[model samples]
Target chain A: MIKIEHLSYHYSNGEQGINDISIEINSSTSLAIIGPNGSGKSTFIKCLMGILKPQRGSIILNNQNINKLSITQRSQHIGFVFQDPKEQLFKSTIEQEIRFALRKRKDQKDIESQVETILECCSLTSHRSKHPYDVSITQQKFILIGCALGMNQDIIIMDEPTSGMDYKGIKQLAKIVEFLKKEKKTIIMVSHDLDFISEHFENVMIINHHQCIYQGTFKDACRDETVLSQGEYKLPDIARLSLMAKHQLCTTHQEWIELWKKR
Target chain B: MAQLELSNFSFRYQGSQDYVLKDINLTLKSGQFTLINGLDGAGKTTLGYALKGIIPHVFEGTLLGEQRLNHKVFQEYTHQELTKIIGYCFQNPWTQLSMIKSTLEEELSFSCENVGYALEETRFRVKAIVRLLDLSHLIHKNPIHLSLGQLQTIALGTILVLDPDVLILDEPTSQLDPLTRRRLFNHLSDLKKQGKTIILIEHNIDDFLELVDHLVLLEKGSILDQGSVIDVYTRSLSIGRDIQYPSLTALLSTITSLDKPILNDNDALTILKGVKSHD
Candidate 1:
């Protein structure tokens, strides 16, 4: 479990990133952090990862104060995949890039075995020897995920992991996230893709102006006009169609279509 | 005459035997919202650049066949002239803006300056664009500090100040929240109403189903489909192959089992309710 208590932060230049807020996230629940850009979503993640020192607050992970933990120590408990693939990938070969995360492990043989497993899981075995730049941007993103998984962190935070990907790639990522959920890992996603987010995640947390405004089912949050407007949340096409059907004829999509067929 | 036309055009990057765009034939008229949908590396971007006169100029490629804008050959226009007539906003908003300005007014002026406008004319256009694109409140803030959606608005404003006839945006809403995407589309619709031609390339088809006037699908460097949205959906179903429609289309398709998928959410819902009552 990750717990945030009265968390507040500001940049060194004195612009507030986050205000006094409190939230608790239990394990095994997939949570999506939705908000407009510059809504302290990224800053909050940085504080959770122990990269930023909050001016005031406490971040507790598994009943331990994460703010007091060292960077290396935090890495053991949390994994992060940044929005930009360029920030995570630095090695010549894809295999090496993933392997670098497991460098501190005790056994070399185990590391190699785990690397192969991750490569297979991410569908990157074919390009294991290829340079990171030679591959597509989506592939680069998967390499980053593979590295994060190799770290064996209890919590995974991915920032817009499906950006610039095709529909198939996005679905593949959804499957991967689902697989992670089956493993009971705590997942936090930051994404603007409403359909993808709604289909994959059950919980949606909206961050607006340095405060948590909405937290509940993805469908519920999407229906709120103020939350939808303030956070700039758009409904997925399926949800929109469902709502539209409900509004126009007071029926579900299936029922409406069946009626049209009879006519 | 059509605003832009590409006849039997094929493009192969230098040193590669394969074409990125093969045997392409497309014509776009004025004041139309054309959405190009495809998987990644399917030459959607390649087509956008070709349409906007970026190919064979910025990229070293083997160009086959002919492309014309307003009855003139594409090669006749310089980069500046092409930009003035056809505004191209890239996928990344930051890389598109070159000015180091602290305010919206300054950025618009910088664009005018790059295009060689008089100082007084620049100020006039800057104010007009700021109001039109709704950048009035953000005019004084540093451009770098703005949100992604705001930066997109600024980029559009900069281009609009030039008064381009055709606007081409590559994945404009890729990183934006859904609501912002809707607002941007509303803005695009408003532009369409004002007679601005738009060519949008996107992977998310459902987002633009109702708004896009024409639909084009590219795969492996070739046009797989092209026509009105209904025409494309009918073709996809006719092929007896399950083509990926937008979510609304998929839902309606499942509900209606029709060859022509319903594009509107309200229509789909109404139909769904009728079906439910019958059952």
Candidate 2:
């Protein structure tokens, strides 16, 4: 479990990145963070990863203050996939990129097998020998996720994982998220891809003006139009259509079909 | 006259055995908006580069086709000459930024300076583009300090300052928030009104369905379908390919057996009201 209390970060230029944010995320749950650009979504994740030291309050992960942990120590528990794949990818081959984190862990045995399994899971087995940049941007994102998963961290934070992905790539990512959830891994994602969020994430935290505007289930978030508008988030198309149809809001076409059949 | 035309265009990058784009033929009339929709690695980005005269000019590749601009062979134009006629916004907005420029204003003017615009003319073009893109407030801010959405606008502004006859954008709104995405598309709509030919490679189809004059679907480096928005979307759906459709179209497809392509919210709502009334 992760707990944040009164966490605030002010940039060097006096701009507030996050303001007095407090939230608790239970173990093995998927949470989607939604907000407009310049919202504190990235800052909150950075704070959780111990990349940025908050000016006030504390972030406790698994009962220990994250700030008290070293960078390597923090990374062992929390894995982060940056918004831009270029920011995280450095290794030449995709196999090496996935193995980069495993090499740091002295306890990790059978490193090659672990890398192979992750590559298969991300469906990158065929591209294992290829350079990271040789693949498309969507593949690069999956490679980063594969690297994060290879670390065997308790919590994984992905920022905008579906940004440059096509429909097929988005489907592949959705399946990966589902697989992770089934494995009881904690996943936190910040994305503007509401369709993906609505389909997968059970809970959502809406941020605006560097503050948490709302935190609840996808259903509740969709019902609360004012909060969504204030957070500058539009409902996924299916959800919007569901609301327009005076039906319970749903995020996927399959759900809409089920509802329609019942009606 | 067609603003841009590609005929029997095929290319393979250096050291690649397979062609990245194969037998692709497309034409863009002046002031028309064309969307290139494809799965990842379907050669959308390569196609964009080909249109911008980058495939043959900047990247070393085997080009086996003809591309024309204003009835002239594309290869006949110099790289600098092509820049004035075509502005290409890369998929990664940061890659398009001029890191040498500290401020957004300077970044926007970098292209005009490179293309040899007079200092006074460069200043005038920058001001007009900043205003057109609603970027006046961020004009003085450092490009590095801006948000991803703001940076994307700046990247677009940098290209627009050149006032190219054709604009080729590769997933420009992929990093943007929904509000910002809509705002950027509105700007594109305004540009389209000004008779600027646009070839956009994007996955967010619903956002620009109404504005798109032509839609092309690509599969494995080949054109699978190309036609009006309705025709291409319908064909995409028929093929069981996972294409992003407007929610209403999907909903209508589910509730009713009707396969009619609904492009916008208003049309979808109107049809929904009719269905509800009939029920």
True contacts kept of each: 0.58, 0.62
Question: TM-score for every candidate vs. truth?
Answer: 0.88, 0.93
- True-vs-predicted CA distance for residue B219, candidate 1, Å: 0.5
Which stretch of 10 consecutive residues in model 2 chain B shows the poorest summed lDDT?
B270-279
For model 2, what is the alpha-carbon lDDT of residue A238? 78
**Tens-digit per-residue lDDT, A15-65, candidate 2:** 788999999999999999988887888888988887888999998888887
What is the C-alpha local distance difference test score of candidate 2?
A: 0.85
Q: Tens-digit lDDT track for model 1 on B71-172?
A: 788989898888778988887677678757777788878999998999999999998888776678778877766655667767877777887889898887
lDDT of 1 at A47: 85
Off by over 4 Å in 2: A104-110, A252-254, B238-247, B250-258, B265-279
Best by lDDT: 2
